[model samples]
Target: MAGSNKDIKVAVIGAGALGLVTLKNLLEEGFDATGFERKSYVGGLWKYTLDETTSVLPSTVANISKQRGCYTDFPYPDDTPSLCASSYIDDYLQSYADHFQLRPRIRLNTAIRAIKRDDANNKWHIEVAPTASASDADTETITFDKLILATGTNDKPSVPKIEGMDTFKGQVLHSQTFKKPEDFKDKSVLVVGIGSTAGDSAVALMGHARKIYLAHRHGAYILPRLHNGRSIDHGLTYNLMTVQKLMQRFAPNVATNMFTKFAQKIQDTAFPSIHEHPEWRLSPAPSLRQTFPTVSDELIPGLESGDIVSVPGLKRVTGPNSVQLDAPKEGDEPMKLDDIDVILFCTGYVNDLGMSLLEPRVHPARNTNPAWLALPGSRGKPLARLYRNVFSLDYPDSLAFMGAAAFATPAFQLYDIASMAVAQVWGVEAHNTSTLPPKAEMERHVDEQHAWILEYARTGPVYPQLTKQFEWLAWADEAAGTNVGANLGWGAQGWTFYLRNRRLYKLLTSGVYTPHLYRIFPSEKRKAWPGAREAIERMNQQLEDELKTKKV
Candidate 1:
């Protein structure tokens, strides 16, 4: 723990949003951290790829948001649009890396194959291979005191294997494969999935596609991006900072109920008036989807003009030029479309950490299902068994996967937290206590989190009422004594004030507080409790009077 800083060597995989943030933090903390990006460029998914036509769109490769998707610490420039193009985001990321002096540490076009524990030296042995085009043919193994896996979730596009997907001759591609609306211009297109990606993609194609069908297996709770000429996401932000605290304090059930009710309210407000058909169908609101910029203002009118047809789930891809849809309502006849020229599946991605490394321990017969692990990879071996969503306890320093857990806000925030924790364990920091969580406890926590997500999803979007999941994550990180607390832009006092002063006065008066409740309080003890409290109260009164008079 007392070693010189020169002794530390950290390698971060994936130089995307999460990777870049981790690299920034590591550099700030004075650690010798290097980054490896598979792409020749810095931005991962933000790097735009084109379809046959060249119009910019949110295809698998195009950048999504420029300003909205960036780090909270470094606000995107004011000139940037809310929904930024992919190129803008890439430029922003490159600028961020440059600003933080992280460019020198990055090794572009490098790919990490496997991370194994070198038990003898208490270090990590990471196998590195250049991308196909790299001049280096042989894979080289590098040893590091610590390893951070920021390889984000977006790298792998989720394309479900429909029975006759390959038979679709006209064109079949995942949302990732989409680049411009012109590709679908004057052509019939079927956009599959109800998640934000699918929704946005469908909206984008409305201008060009001759006939656009937005299909989903289940109904999703549709809420407007704006209400009454104001941004709905902004309202959610305000409510998250205020209402959530009040509910958690005075009435827990009431707070939970509010999310559902609010979501319903938003859905109601969004339909008929804003959206053409508000009552089409309701599905669970995808939390990750909220992070992306909602459909732009220019596109909303078209959505209302009936350019986009909301269709039920896909039954099958009948042929190269046609597809079938299950009726939206039960007992209704199936609808077939014979002239569709393209199908874009916006189905979700699977979290698969390639299982080539842990073969013997995670063989199929062992019943180590990857789903059981919570972090996907091989069957029988759930990644949840690792401590703090970090190292595998059974395989000491063998592997650590960052940015695995799905979060509402930027995954980079959590990745940064994970990276810091890894740094602490590696003794790269002055004081290291990141490995405190026992493997068993970490596994239980992950299990509970998964259970919570499944139940939340099953129940449907708790909108307006549901606590912003990111806030809870921030609190969890704080309790774990991680850097997430510092990264929390606003102070905890906002929610604390709403709950303690307004909603649940009884609990505050009763002096009954849960252990979780105490984590938010300052650690210092008050001396001369009654006198100190009275003096503080007097100062508050004086401050209030001066503010009332508009005099500081």
Candidate 2:
């Protein structure tokens, strides 16, 4: 169903980084696109708020380097810190909106009330209301030919139900509600979970809280932001995406072993020796295959300095302001933590699509297939059975989800490419419809991916976006017809393109692998920017300077 962009109208929800990019791509493709954000301002989670929205903690810093964190065409300002703060991220996003002139089309303080697709007419009927308006009657209906859900994966906070949490009278707060360090002044706090948020909050509250207990059942591989005096993403991990893909494809066993060793080396250097501590009840160190490593620079030092007390899994609340903990070791006595003035859960967010925004008919988990319904950890949790975690299997043509997947790499370019793919598919029928695989085939791919994830995440709720960077990038490139792999000898030209363009090929292979590389070559549906090469060179030179001044 190739359609002229002159008549196509697209509705993009959530004007965060992801949504902004989607709107930009849709507009560039000549479609009439409008963005709707529930919050009064843009920058979804990056915009810190006291409300229910999940955002960065006050001490949050860029785990991924600024170079990788930026959009393809728009690099972060040269003065931006190596590991910039959340405020810098927010400002960068706002600047992006301003640079693209996207503010005029964005409707802030507008929340999507209901979304129902008219099957007969092949159109979306979206009911929107003022974010402050509580009444359903104060809504207006708008029609669009296509819908893009940029609402993001981290909007809803996932708070765990702890036994006897009701009895704790002091204070209970999720990381989403954590305002500032002063709020916990002189208070004995319990930080549950060892995710990035947990580490950041515990470190941030070091001097503020009188006592801080960092609780987790399993041992986490907490990596430092810097590896070898450079940001982790600026070095090996960022440069090895294509290499990882090739090795995994050609020599799976060899690649797995090498990667395991590489990860172990990083863990040995970055993570503290807390794993061998006699008092803490952290479980055995899990393999990289089991879970992703958390990036934190100060958590280990804080633990070692006795600023943050590491404890075992919480059993239950023995009494108000007191909690019973599991034994440090088997047959060891259980520990009790008392005088806890505040309990802060640093648990991650949920990406379930069962929110009231969309009707059940177009729900992300609308598929009735038994295989699709059997979600790991979450039996009935609604997840989008999306192909490549972007296109809705049920309505791939008219509906898409941006920034749905989390990866080891940066999200800016990944979502940008996804948006481009969506544009190509929706803008021209021959570019996508005729080239797209059948729905059944797409469903089968989704099922296989879910099966792979289920095998690893057998216990906890698996977020659908937990995918490998290389695999997802390859899939997105194929859909967008970008032929990014061509330079790497993984496409039609194979290795010939490397010879034809040695300078660009060398940069692509050995350089910093910045986000701008995605915009280096023009495609049928995408035009390359002349500044892409300059951006890449600048980033590479910046890295060289950093390496010269700093010692590993």
Candidate 3:
């Protein structure tokens, strides 16, 4: 993955965590990079808002632990709790921005409204605007050697176009706009979507609302965030190479016993309709994609207590304050919910990347089903056709995205690597394999990634197997100089760093693939960003003064 540096001038859209890391890294690597944020701040989706751009719910917490959620270079403050709140996420991002001096390169209240290409030089012409709001400002046309669309999938609400949606007399909202469960007080609410937001809404709204209907087509696995008081995400480190060895050489039942013990500690919880009749889980497909064992802990408890009502996928909007619900059994007659007050579609985002920005010749995410594949008209949504989930298949290094996949893994960890790959793909950074492949080769990779993402979306919790995500990160680590995926080493104190990860190191070396004893490879010397040491030193001094980090 090597290429010649073109002294590329890059414009990154949406300065969230992904944008911050990317702009910071690109600047350090000596690229003429500038970041444009539609909002007045640096944090993107992580920064919760009441406007149309909001992505996070007020009650949101990282489904994964703080250890798993953080960037490679910066650690969360020790005071930060496990399974940290999104507010802390906001803080962590701000801290990263401050550490890297990213603000200077970032233009707040700026947006890339549209994009065009300079066919002659293989560059991108980006249309710029001052605000994401209705107040029209003088639009400017600017050009860049490359563009990174880090505007995440979560911002845009993927509301399904129901027949007679406007006819509903009651309020209709997307989970993106939901702030508190208390808002739906005494009203019967149908919370749509099946991811963490839906789970949080259903569980929180229970007992508060007159009745809570957890709507879904395909049922998802309702998982607990904390198992026996420890974050289950952090517990994944138990995947030891020695454990793999035992499963292979001496005892096959070892794996079974391990799984049972883990499962015994966990419980199977689903919407009551699906839980009571396991067969109905098949009706709403793409339902299982949102259900991981650790996605939402409160969903099951809420269901069991009769606090949340369960309904099949929404079939049709029959009238104002009325809708037809699909039955648990596919061919069964649709049931009618005549008294519905608020319909909160918990459905996930559609990442229709740069429809206005990208020319027709270039491909964006082909599957743009922003409704998270729940509706019939998902043809135009933003499930992307990205290469290795980073670069665009049609445009290669010149056009790319960060944090594209709707993954269950720690996001910033993934986004950080994708950030590095942008530089790697552009041949702007020196690494062992820094060459950008030919267009055909890049397209082939995109096709391969497209298939993998589709499969992951289709197959449920099995995708949460951390090793596969590690393999993906390893691909990013190859591009970035950080060998985190290579062996999981970052700056930490002594055995404090490697003790917990010794088994992870062994597991990385294990040859067995199952059941995810996935493959990993040694990386060549991770080339540092030009003058990275000095940059880090400055960051450390600033953080020491700001964060007051203790010196061991």
RMSD of each: 8.9, 2.6, 7.8
| lDDT by residue for model 2 (1-552), tens | 425785888999889888999999889878889999888888888877777677876568988888888888899999999799999999999999999999999999897888998999999999989864668778899999999988877766677777898898889888878878887899999999877888888998988999999888777667788877778777653347767777878986787778777766776687647556646543455555545676788887887889999998778887788998888778989889889999888877667532347788777766644553464544344556788877788888888887667666678878888888888777853434324579999989888877776665566545456766677787777666666766565565856887688887878778877778778877665678789888988888887887888754
lDDT of 1 at 549: 75
Q: What's the distance in Å from true for residue 177, model 3?
A: 1.8
**Where in model 3 is the C-alpha error above 4 Å?**
1-7, 132-137, 238-265, 268-294, 330-332, 366-383, 428-433, 451-471, 484-552
**Predicted candidate 3 versus true structure: per-residue lDDT over 414-449, tens digit per residue:** 676667667755653444366566777866765565
How much is the lDDT of residue 193 in candidate 2? Answer: 85
**What TM-score do all the candidates reach, one by one?**
0.73, 0.93, 0.77
Pick out the ten consecutive residues of candidate 3 with the lowest summed lDDT.
511-520
Best by TM-score: 2
Candidate number achieving the greatest lDDT relative to the actual structure:
2
Report lDDT (Cα) of residue 309, candidate 2.
92
In candidate 3, how many Å is residue 372 off?
14
Query: What lDDT would each prediction earn against the true structure?
Result: 0.55, 0.78, 0.63
Candidate 2 or 1, higher lDDT: 2
> How many clashes does each candidate structure show, in the order listed?
23, 1, 22
Count clashing residue pairs in model 2: 1
